[model samples]
Target chain A: MKGIAKKIQASEVETLRLRLTEAEEALQAIAKGSVDALVVGGPRGPVVSTLAGAQEPYRLVVERMHEGALTLGEDRRILYSNRHFAHLLGYPVAHLVGKPVANFVAPEDAARLADLLDHGAKQPASRELKFRRRDGSATPALVGVGSLTLDQTPALLLIITDLTAQKHSEELAAAERFARSILEQATEAVVVCNADGRITKASFAAERLLDKPLEGKLLADAVPMEVELPAEAHHSGVRMSSREVLELVLERHSLRGAEAQICLPRLHEKHFLLSAGPLSDEPGGCIGCIFTLTEITDRKRAETQQTMLVAELNHRVKNILAIVQSVAWQTLSANHSPSEFKRAFDGRLRALSLAHDILTQGRWGHVDFEQLVERSLAPYHGGDHGMRAQWSGSRLSLPPNMVVPLSMVLHELSTNAAKYGAFSVEHGRVNIAWRSDGVNVLFTWTETNGPPVKGEIKAGFGSKLISRVVSYDLLGTADLDFDREGFRCALTFPVPKLRTDALRPLSAAPSPVH
Target chain B: MKKNAEDLSGYNLRLYIAGQTPKSIAALSNLRGLCEKYLSGRYRLDVVDVMADPALAQRDEIIAIPTLVRCVPEPIKRIIGDLGNSDRVLTRLGIDVSAKV
Candidate 1:
């Protein structure tokens, strides 16, 4: 009985020691952990007891953790765990205390985890490790491990903090860097300015435009003629001094105005036109200005050369008029009698004058076929009643080069009508029809109600002139037909010479010769 | 038009005047004793001095001085003159003469 009591007493001491150690560990765990507890029951001896003296372990490493704690030992088995560790793995502590750690890890990560833990156990340091959860999700955690004695056997205490949020922030930061790089390297110039008209940010193209560094400079101070207050604000019922209105409108319209060219001073001896637009975020509020440079020196030079060529063309047309005037005088000098001379001279001069008028109306570019016909028939009509003239079919305007020829052709037709066709009788009529057939212009002049038909014995200078102009000068076909009722003439010319692409040919639509 | 009695109850007036300029000072004291005795408490006077800030003159478009804008009477009337005579001022303003009380 004495030996049995001694053995029981020794077992009681061991139990007491274990109770003391567990009580200390529980106190330390409560202090380190954030879990809420309502009851703190003292270590239960053989009989339940409530003690106020709870000793805290000294020189003990208590790790602050989130998610779970794992105690990995030899043979890869889970030796011990807190309630939180079992909860994290979706298992009860009683069922997990001796379970293999591989049960919770995925097969792929388990091999890696096992190798990492084996390597980790050989080293005496703490590290961050990724763990696989029982739900097949990855848990990135900061794992702290240390050698410890539990029940007189060596083991590991692992405390972890989830790093998922930190990793997400890192990924977001990397994405932001990528976006910033794209914005910085964009091709078009971008400038960001504040409400105060200060250019806070500018792109690489700004250096190309400004030709100098412009960091930390006020926009108005850096760029000339950049005003702060909008031009409208100054014009709103507020009287301003002279030059204020000019300045206001110039600033308002910026680079757009009548002959208001914005010239960016030659960079590397090359000039460019500067176009600008106001950036506005709100109605009636001018935020800032965005200006782009477009090289237009070649275009301007081309336009100037074109205008000069047009002027030279007008001069040549005037010379042609002088030649026609001399021709009229020569034809009159060759006439036999004074009456015939005066009649021929006046007729030729009138025809030349009418052609001149048509050319003038075209600005020396082109003339309408309808206008030329009407002008030629005006004298034969005698006052709108003697000779009736009717026009039908499409409206056609011939270019200046074709105008001189077409006018001469019409003059011949009208002269023949006055001499023998329509205008020879008190009541007669002339009809002119014109239209575009593909790339050719067709015009037919028919005359009726005239004296008995008597063809001319010899063709006059006017007839010869018409033939030369239509057949050679204009590269067209013309025919004169003398029917018993009247005289008819038909002409056709290619349309390319009449089109505007041949240097500003007159508008196709007809304008009356008022 | 029916006229109000020249009693104390009818002629309620408030004049907004600014700083003692020749016009403003003259406009103030010229009608003070004469109008007060005639209009009494029915005429409440309010004077705002504005010579310190010429902006105030611009705000009201006040060009000539000693300008009086009538406030209390409906279709408020205005006149520009030094308050030298009580008779003309009273007649132009259409103040009642029979009941001076």
Candidate 2:
């Protein structure tokens, strides 16, 4: 009211003098003496008459209506909304005047509205709040509720602005940042590729395994260049269209060579076992391949060594078992009592043990066959100047698996010849010769000058173990002959299984280094 | 001490409280301890003091003691009492406050 009085006081007589009559009528009702005078000044008598002619039905343009003219009346129902107030909450002026404003607010926000209303009644000021919309959604808005009058009737006004979009974007940005952080820290290597099989993105491990910047290389071309593949490999159509992929892997890995071990390749002075599998697009296309490379060189070497050691141990156990059988059979054949058989059997076992110690000392690859024979027969042939054992043929380093069985077989036969065949008399001599027959290995044990041997129809455990080893483990052929003069046995197996390298000439005389 | 929590760019805070009580009072009191710690500079604290401000506490959606709000850092972050949980508060504050808890 003071502001209106100030405006009226400051108005020039020319601007207010004509409207003075109507202004006086309106002010008389609200602030009876507030307007001392009224005036209207603009244009001349003809424009004034034209204005007067239009006045009775013309719309009164209410200027400076800075009051809470919108009303929620005694019934708490909205009864009127002026153009300015209706536009404040995005309502059409005619549509909002008779509707309850509470219907437009969200139900959940109504409690907040009640709280704000209580606050507003005590301390009226502009505040931030959410407004209910006609569409049943609520919007964050700034509402200013104050006490005012509309043509002398009391009312309330609310002004609002929608803040949903701004708040939603901030939330979305925060979620995006969190997702990006998890992606960057993922444990599995992640690679993104385009439909052409070119790499679009790669993780840190890919850079190290590929040994090159592969941000844009075709995957099919990239695989072969990275590893050596085998020549004979044919793809079995397991995964890829090209069978050449298997050959490429074999060639790259160096698996064909005798010395080669299928394992990881060296990288930065370390080694990594690498594998690659294709990544396909969700909607039908080959995007690229994901490569996994793990450091496995130490593990591979250890496994190979362990396998070899186990195989060698198994072979040795079978051989010792055969030697024990021979001792028992020979003692039984000589008609010995249990105590004598045990004593004699123990001596033979010790001889076999000594031979084993020598071979093991040499890491079990090969033992001097001649030195082995001399050591085994020496106990029985002691002080007999005429007895002799001879070895003839090439000396080759036999693989450990072959050496144990062959040594035990020879040991058993020599013990037999000493007890009942050629070496029973002082004039005995034994000749053992070995030679390679292409892929077959042949070794002969020939004895001469013992008590004249007669055919014995008995089959012993010693012979059985020898046959078992030759047929099953060694995958070979064996023959034993009992002749009138002596006994001879010949054994044969695949050459490659016995010898590790080409055979070399043997020293005619037994090497004393045994 | 004024550590990484004060240096955080945005509001990222978590308040771990047993329930609504007033040892939460000392916590809030000590958080005012950080008034000189962070807000002495340019920070806004929507003190979810968890007592008189319990409804605002629900808005900040906190379950712990004397929590502090890092309003200026963005998205509005809350840190519970037991000021010892400073590092986690700082890291969370470093991230936008409106992110997943």
Candidate 3:
């Protein structure tokens, strides 16, 4: 019992000592400002207490700004910097403070920045400079400078705006403008369209060829282009419609080197060599399309005209060959000797060739009567200066058949006058006149002033040939008379209707004269 | 040790902070981590922003910011600073009696 009583006293002393130690610890904590709360009996109850006012709200604004902020001391050392400023230079905020601002500036721009900050510190200034990152890459920034007194010391405040995204967009816009100017100046017609086939841009050549204000209009409305895609790409390899063609250029992003036809409203159609490609921010990512229309109208017209000319030339050559064969047969059969055949055949072929010259001069269509007379009789008149043979007629266009036969008849008459009639003597004359009587052309040849017909002259091959051609080929009648005054011949034939006949030989489509 | 972890319950703590200052916020953060690692769901923590409750700051004994008070489990304790030094915090409160076991 006595031991148990002693143990109880010992336990009570230990509890008191522990309470004393807790008190001492609490006092130490209070002195160190480590105590969380002091429970005081108030008028109502024990309540929690708090400290004084909080930090300035303006500091939050500075920390949350979009642009970077930096405070530099007189020694150019960074006295303070926000999170944004440190991030702009790829450094931690704690690592950036008290470091020289010039260390982060590019080597080339560092001197210029120092000069501005030193010489122009009084005035607010803004300048562009490159801020180098910790990883050695440089970023463009617009640095705005101002002076402020920070804690009784003069300091410089810098507001830095990163220009990476801004500069990238500006450069892309400038490059697009450059590309547009080049396309506008190019001689080839080019049209740039958006993904939806809107006419965003048109070249000068395209504007002139389309002859319309093309901007903001649908490309299909401005230039109704039709392209012929290959059979594998489309059906039938035929012409695609305007909308389908635009879809082919935009959606398919194809039609490279294809033949395309552009037909604007109320304007003649134009052909172009088409090339299309996509405009994209990256490869395989299409934003829009660019079409290059190289005009091929003149080349197409030339090709068509060449084909038609070949066909026409082939037909004309065969006709000429048939005519020559017949003339050779007649001349060979009629003449009794080689010398006579050579002379007659040569004269007939020369007459036919002279008539062909007039027909060719009229584009292988018809002959002008006056031109035919002048060219055919010039040789008989001693190279046109010593001409005693004179012909007068109204302005008439002869048909193709009349040309060869009449030229032969005129040649025979002139030869006869030169050999045995008016032209055989020095002082001689021949007067040829033709008059059209609504349907028939009455042509009369009168010769005088040289020699008289002395005897009965039998019909030679030249005379018989002239009569037969006037009756057969010309479909006319000839009356010949040999009198003492001179030899006379009167022939009549139908006048030609030259309205539609003049247009038949041009055998391509209704292509323009050009 | 399993019984010690299970015995870590009803440790009520009160924290006093002066708004969002760095030390004030860090103390709360560190205290939370310490509770989560050692006490977890067994502790109740009450935060008092002195800026919001100015009348509470009139208690001069509690004016030091980022002060933490262990109000439960008898013999109330007080701690200071960011509670960043876990060993000091645990030792000062004799909470190592539970942790070091």
Which candidate gets the maximum DockQ versus the true structure?
3
TM agreement with the true structure for every prediction = 0.34, 0.33, 0.63
lDDT of 3: 0.73
List the candidate 2 regions with Cα displacement exceeding 4 Å. Answer: A1-91, A124-132, A142-154, A190-400, A403-514, B1-101
**Candidate 1 local lDDT, residue B85:** 57
lDDT at residue A255 of model 3 (Cα atoms) = 65
- Compute DockQ for each candidate against the true complex: 0.00, 0.01, 0.07
* Predicted model with the maximum lDDT: 3
What digit string (tens of lDDT, one per residue) describes model 2 on residues A1-514? 9999888776655345524533443344224321111122325311111112242232122212532234454333454444554544566543453355666667776777666655654566665666665555667666666655544765555444445676678788998777455435644334444545566666555554555665786545543323333244243222332123333332332222111122235443444444555555568455554444455568766786677667656655655676566546755776458886676577556755775666667655456655665666666654644447777776654554554566556666866776777766777888878888678778888888768755564756456656766776567888987777678889888774444342211111111110
| Residue A384, model 3, lDDT | 49
Candidate 2 DockQ score? 0.01
Candidate 3 C-alpha lDDT tens digits along A377-436: 787675644868888999888766567777878888887887888888877888989989
Q: Report the Cα interface RMSD of each model, rounded to 1 decimal.
A: 47.8, 29.8, 8.6
Please identify which of the two predictions, 1 or 2, would achieve the higher DockQ against the true structure. Answer: 2
Error of 3 at A464 (Å): 4.4
Q: What's each prediction's clash count?
A: 7, 30, 4
Instruction: Tally clashes: model 2.
Output: 30
TM-score (chain A only) for the predictions, listed in order:
0.39, 0.37, 0.71
TM-score of 3: 0.63
